[model samples]
Target chain A: MNSSSVAARGTVRVGPSGRYAWIALTAPLAIVLLLFLVVPILSLLRASFFEGDRSFNASGVSLEHYLRFLTDSYYLNVMLDTLGYGLATALLCLVLGFPTGYALARAKPHWRRWGLIIIILPLTLSLVIVVFGWLVVLGRQGLVNQVLVFTGLIDKPIRLLFNSPAVIIVLAQQFLPFMVLSVMSVVGHIDPTLEQASANLRANRWTTFRKVIVPLSLPGILSGLTLVFVLSVSAFITPRLIGGHRVQMLGSLIYEQIIVLLNWPFGAAMSAVLFTVTLTITLIVNKWLKSHPG
Target chain B: MQTRRTFLVSTVAAGAVLAAPAIVRAKPFDNVTLTLNGFGGDFDRIMKETVADPLKAETGLDVTYAPGGSSAAVAKTIATPDNPPFDIVLCDSPSVPELIKADMIDPVTPDKVPNVANLLPGLPEFGQHGVPFMISSSVITYNTEETQTPIASYADLARPDLEGRVALFNLENTGGVLYLLAMAEANGGGIDNIDPAFAALERIKPNIVTLTSSTVSLIQLFEQREATAGALWNGRVFAMQNAGQPMAMVAPSEGIYSLMSYYNPIKGTKHPEAVATYLNKALSDEAIGAIANFFRYGPTTTVDLPKAVADTIITFGPEGRAKIKTLDWTKIAEKRSGWIERFNRTMA
Candidate 1:
């Protein structure tokens, strides 16, 4: 090679060129992470430790807020209930979503597209609107009760809304799309020949699904569980709206402390706990998925 | 050279001073726009037509209204007290202590707003820092179509006949907190002691179809027949009644608490005089009457509203609205979070 051409090639291999490429790829995301996520989280953590009662302390910090959470059984119950509610919602979404996702994956192209659209249609609506829709459907004199009464199923309208079950149903409806879409993405990539091979091996449909298809979609299932569980745990509206006074989730408690009572320290402390628990759960699930390689 | 220059300057200064009165006569408002924090929807429309428009006309200052929740407004003010987002903010009386603590508001004086003298006798006087514009009340409302008997007192909620038919406010709401206090008072305890109220609430827990935090939820419960009787604001009950709902507003025999809406000039405002003037105009007879008619609230001022309009107002009774009760709001704010947590834990 000529000397000039060799010099140009040498320049291309320098660290600055590769460093520039890396920086270009990550700069925007790093800036966004610092400004929006990391900074806010640090501030919230700091605020969590501040002395607050009608106002936050500017001079000093304390652990009374966090200690309250540890000592107060009511708050402990709220945390446990929040986690339980999230788990139940996630499980419901998985069971109900898996079949729809599998059906979509196995359907014709047009059918698959239409089915996906219909499954995700509710996702486009705001949570408040969706809850309002549920209200109209599940209220005491709502559509379901009216229909049941018309069919002579019962003498009086059953109390259907304002309960934990209503909250779960609404939450399931809200998060089902996430579960279905994630599972569909994984299931769609599974080879049809593998299932056929299992069938040719004298495996029944249920066995084929259990042994072959389920393992292949484990990653999707894990991701959907993480998404639904995290969202459900952090949800404030569904529990407040559908659960009413019958149910009290951690999110609602946090909302009450901050917004209603203007108790920032306690609210921030509760939020920090929620964030830590959610992060620990997510990281553990992710680690499990990575270790299992499924 | 010095004498000639001084003469020239003096002539110009004198001429400008002589012409100042004519200039004042020409453009009174001088294109100043005042920002007001208020509630939206029908309240916004009524406030604009009755208070804002007339104030603008009288003072020559243009008015701009921004609406949001009182808590949000207080938060915003607290966030930027040095540079408040709005010139005037209409807030609830309960939030006054916090605002005062945060130093987010400026004090009013008699010279600034003459209408302050005309406010009702029992209303609060925050050293002129906040002025009560109107008084809204929390009352029990029943769906006439569904309810066979009138809800006469707070005790009626615990009766078996009202079982599974009542809806109460969630503790987050001021009305709900007042309800709790009223129940406590009726059940041999007072505001300082709310355990009795909790017991009362527990007794009526089966009757409470739901606990709501907003007028929309209360109205929905009534409309859907989920709740035949609910703890509701008198104004919303009136709105529902006007909307052709089979709803009736009842001032319970146990008494109801007043929720006073106050207007205050934001701290560090440039147009303090304009804000004070607007507040005064808001308290004027015509404006107060219009506001009372619109929201079905009692005017803080002694305005002679039409008899038909007066009949609908809770504070327009022959006893001159003296039956209303109120709690120590500062105490409420201090202990509210604990009470809410307890309520959440105890409620059905």
Candidate 2:
């Protein structure tokens, strides 16, 4: 073949030369990731085996911490609770966020702008402040209880904070914006004509939403789930603040070992477990989505 | 304009006169800035107002306060022994041994901190290694208005009437571990044998509203009437009462456990003299009184507190001294990790 034809074929193929260009483009980022992310995690993994408080002796390297976690039911329960809380948060966010996201996507300009602001306002505030605010709002004599008692709906205030329900509520509130924004972006991209076509075919509103809108927004929903799930699993502040000691998540457990007990080895080991669990769950979700694409 | 100028001139003159001693003493450390690390929350605020602010005004040493727990501070300092971030660190009694073991702190001599001579006897004396900052006793604090029956002992935390309405400290806190010791002692055990403590804690599991580290949460629990009683420091109980929460603290009949919070100068501080001067100021009569006024912790120094303030502070009064539970710091430093595990296990 002639040079021009060969070049055209090479461009279409994105051959080995293209691979080199791509690698070169991504090389700096790869190096950064290796240095900051991979190396630190590998160091944590290495440190996890060393016994004692920050003093790691090379001769004392063992799986004592991991063994403690594996044999102990208490640690296992914490692991289960962490994953369970993450799953509950992701599902709750989806349920609460999808409708709000859809409504925002379909709203008038002014209303949509304000609605978006309200949803994203929590993101602007720090997590500590958010949790503190929730504490005041959901405390035994908080706004809800005060209102209820004032209206003669209840004789006394109920215990609302520092429980599983309180944790779920706070987590849902903290991360709902992520879910909304993610789903909104995808919903905004869909052609309005599809919904109109579904309507013209006499599909009811609910039917249209389920059959057309939801399927179209599956990518966003899945992505939102992953983001929310990972964030919830790694959450330390909310449960720490409002959940009190009643609710224990993996993030707080790791914090307890590392900061409170000064057992860096055990803390690092717990961190490794968290990292592996989150990575495996994320990969599994991604693979499932890929295999069953909408 | 003439009157305003006169007022400004007089103010400047008076300020200079008052600051003359501090300025002279500060001449040597004119450019030095000491970093101080201590507990956060109310303690940080009180330390700033009572200790750091006055020291800065008197000595001209630019002090930066980094608030953190003692263990975390110890870990950070141990990680960088030769060039530590903090010039001086305020840690609880349990943390001193670990620091001493690591050789992170410089010894404090009476010559460096003359106020060390005024500290109460039998308080943890590191023999020039550390000086007592304040003394806090763990007590069973309750809302006087909420509960009909008075809580007289630590064991009263598990009273059936208090079920679902008690707030206790998490195991990692200094006051918290001390509370555990109190519980153990009340149940015929001590720190060395903490099994009884764990069992006692488990028995009170139903009454435990939460085991929290936040002083705000603990206060809110009582203020909102969610929790009627729990284990807390006498100073914290005093704070709650001062805030108009109708709170009262009961030093358990068995005995009360007190934590003698200590402060030490790190070995590699650039301004060791400045550190010494600041710590001396911290132990001064006026500063200690201010701390007692605000938080109700007993002054480590032998300053005669007014009766109103003295009544609330827990110290080595002939009777109070006899009741203070002695904790073995070295043993605690070794077994703390396991104790925390057991605490979590039982609570979880």
Candidate 3:
């Protein structure tokens, strides 16, 4: 082949050889995913349809577990509450993360590195430890109460932990870095001259940010929201520790079924439902994002 | 060039030298290792220092420890029955029935472990599939500095003054199950009729701040003064008190709910001989005494303890043991899931 053709071949394109190369490159990953992910999921789905305990299937296949979960008002409420918490956490993270991510993207190289390190520091610690740290800070005689009482805001310490707000706040804090990192990656690639050009066209700071910056950063915002929401809904330890008995999430319920109660079939059914719901939401979001490309 | 006699003599001498070490080092069950699922943290340390190391010296067999809760152990066994993770499991009373029902454990008889004979009377009646090693009771534990009034009975938890201060155990924990049973019996109901338990829970619902299955989180709650009083295992209470925390435990007027922890040999263990030997060692006076001294749990074997220590352990003597209210574990295991769901609903 000529030099141009060789160069063209080196650069990936949609041809028979390129397609084969792509297949070869992804073959290992495809095998790994099939073995670890798809196989286990299929097994879980099968277990969900089993009539009796995982060890015994003599009773035949049925959807009794699913019916029970769907029909029960208590389980339905838990599912709704979990989704609500996920949405609230995603919104909270977006509100807090957008500015931080923007600042980091526009910062000097050294400052940006330090900012990234600070954002990622909590992720390095164990989730259990972080939850415990939150307990100490939000307890009745904790820092917030102490500060409030000292300032004469209240005469006595109020209950700060073991409630819905605490669970959402702690979850948002736990997953904030994911949102920030997602936004930062995409925002960093956006041309700053566009914002300057918008300013030159007599647009105010807020207007420029709203019309130009936000629209440009749509991909990052969508990804961050999806990531945070999915993670928040499936989180068990944080809600269990912080929300206590008053707040019951679907994740903790599923955990109780599988680990504590040892009801594998019921747990599998709940898991299948959660997976389906999450996957469906993700697919719809992706489709919407594709249709409304920035 | 060498004579036959000289060659034979030299060969025999070499053989004797090589065989002498083997003869001297020969031990029953040598090179055999068994894994035991034990309670982690200080319990594992005490067991290692008391039972595991001594058993290793007594027999050439080695005993490795894997630390986790009894439920986790049972679940692992059920998941992999043929090739179980641990050869032997240490489980509580609630788990014993489940294990028996599943036929996951082998019957540990007097022929295998001679020390099984020394176990407290009536323990053998509980089950022969495993050897009982330690005894603990569920009692009311409170932070003395934080609690204003003395807690005497389980019903006192419903007092208006202690509202929103109590930290309770969720139904998943064995202690939690015992608490519910104790509440039921204290009221007009028993294990068969648990409606009274739910009613009592409703009465005390205003006082409940948190319900959890974690011992560590419970202790943290006490340390942080988030919980003033709640039901907890006596051993953990004693540990916290010994650590200089202002914690005290009371055997309520209702009666102490006793629990027996057992060492069960898996049914299909490759090292049955080693497991039996290890159990015997674990049930010996020295091992049981060490565990009692460290954890303040009543010893299943007839090992003598100091009067002060014995007095502290509610299940130590006949009188203390008499105060223990035993329930039908089979019924508890059968109704546990439903009870847990109801408890969650009631508390929620």
Candidate 4:
């Protein structure tokens, strides 16, 4: 009885000591985070309020840079465009990825592993290469046009090369895995019997999916949606390359400000805005996930 | 149990994802333990053989070199105003403003490097601030097989016949945009008046087969017979023509964007004198030839090129130089966002 009590005590998570050990274990990471992640972010925040030839210490802080982003319709349009793309990507990922996840989940063990790898093939290739490949296929002299012309599919090649839709499709393709992985992981945890039980109780397969599996996957779906949305919002390469400078995302804008224009403060402000907007959406989604029963 | 493992894995994965940009530093300076801070590619090698090895031979300074992806790499080094990380740096034209903004380039007075006189008069934008090392400019190019007429004008780039066969430069680089603006200027279109030309550009938009971000690939397209007509630098065109590609260069009826390459003495560098010696050598006739050979760009020296080569370059003649409109970088820098927005809206 005494030994059992001792073992129970051992199993208990220690409070501060556990945290201390965790901190110790992650100390290298913590130090790296402090110097790299934390410092740069803080520097970015500090930079937002100041422009060129301006000091950040005590005398130079201003609201002009933030105001500049807010007032500029070009930037505002881009922000809206990015948000639109993100939402579209999230929706498409859910629609396509759900079935793909279902296929993977229902597959035999060996096939499931292979299925998982095949799903991750896009992720394996470099983003630049993917964008370049897409460009070659989509451009004027690209293969699609040649093939289409040979087949007489249309009189002339449709402008698939550069547009917002191109960004949406590319982004959906890039981020589909995030949604699949999230929902698949959760679906794997679910007992198969619950689904069967619902179907066995005179419920159709669609009804079983609608009621049992879907409700259970709702939280995972929400999480995936939020993640994919945020990622799509900030994705620079796809929009920049595939969209042909038309699908301007907030990420590309930040890159321009930081790298091209050398407007660190403006870039930082833009980043802060991005971070806040993304975080707000994420929190709202998280709250929705919590309040609504899955 | 699997879910628990998955959660832990995801948490760690998220942490790493958050930490990625903070950790990897693009290998900082490549390969060698000690690094030389200059433009990468053959320039790095030339400096290694000529300057870096001898320095290491004398002082045991370990050195390698990194290529500038964009001007930002050089900008960050200038911002801190600390022990400047690069031993020496070969920067492009755009980086000049950044260093100027930071006041990081140690003002090399005439007292330091006497060979400063060799720089063409009123040439170095940053006064006594950097050693003027190399210079090159984009000359209009045409495919010999495709076009029968001489490609002499910026207006020629907008020909209806070349429609759908045109090539676009990478918008990401300063060079392409600058080239476009120079074309605009030649066509009696300043930034304010660029709309009609941009509208015309929209007509030619469908012909843009490849949008190359790489200058090498831009030149290579000429060699490969992939693109018919595009604005290419003289050096690249010459290199291609020499390599047996039937490419021709045009002295622009208007102008070209000249890339003036130079070595700026980063403030607080340990070896300013060494930097000066290297800069002096770089401007010298022999070193300029080496750079010219390496990059295929024209020399900064007043010495005349061979007649055959001079005939090929747009900036070769006094008349050509007079016609070229110099970009006021300050004005361009200030209203750049507006230009980009108009460009973005019209370009596609």
Q: Say which candidate scores most in TM-score.
A: 3
CAPRI-style grade of the A/B interface in model 4: incorrect
Which candidate number has the best lDDT?
3
Give one digit per residue, the lDDT tens place, for model 2 in B6-57. 9999999999999998667755556778887867777777777877777667
TM-score of each: 0.88, 0.88, 0.93, 0.80
Clashes of 4: 7
lDDT of 3 by residue, A140-254 (tens): 8799999999999999998899999999999999999999998999899999999999999999999999999999999899999999999999999998999998889999998
Q: What is the C-alpha RMSD of each candidate to the true structure, in Å?
A: 5.7, 6.4, 2.9, 12.9
Model 1 CA deviation exceeding 4 Å by range: A1-15, A54-57, A106-113, B1-37, B53-67, B80-85, B270-274
* Model 4 alpha-carbon drift over 4 Å, by segment: A3-31, A51-59, A117-125, A140-159, B1-39, B42-62, B109-122, B142-151, B161-172, B180-229, B237-248, B284-286, B302-311, B316-338, B345-348
Q: State each candidate's clash count.
A: 2, 1, 0, 7
Model 3 error, position A114 (Å): 2.9
Q: State the local distance difference test value for candidate 2.
A: 0.82
Q: Which ten residues in a row have the lowest lDDT in candidate 2 chain B?
A: B312-321
Error (Å) of candidate 1 at residue B266 is: 2.3
lDDT (tens digit, per residue) of candidate 4 on A1-294: 576686687866567777678768998998999999999888788888775523322237788878887998877887888898899999999999988887777778999999899889999999978887776676556788778988999777655755788788888989999999888887887789998898789999889988898989888788889889999999987876676544678898787667666667778898999888998999898889779856
TM-score-based ranking, best first?
Answer: 3, 1, 2, 4
At residue B127, what lDDT does model 1 achieve? 62
For lDDT, candidate 1 versus 3, the one ahead is 3
State in Å the error of residue A45, model 1: 0.8
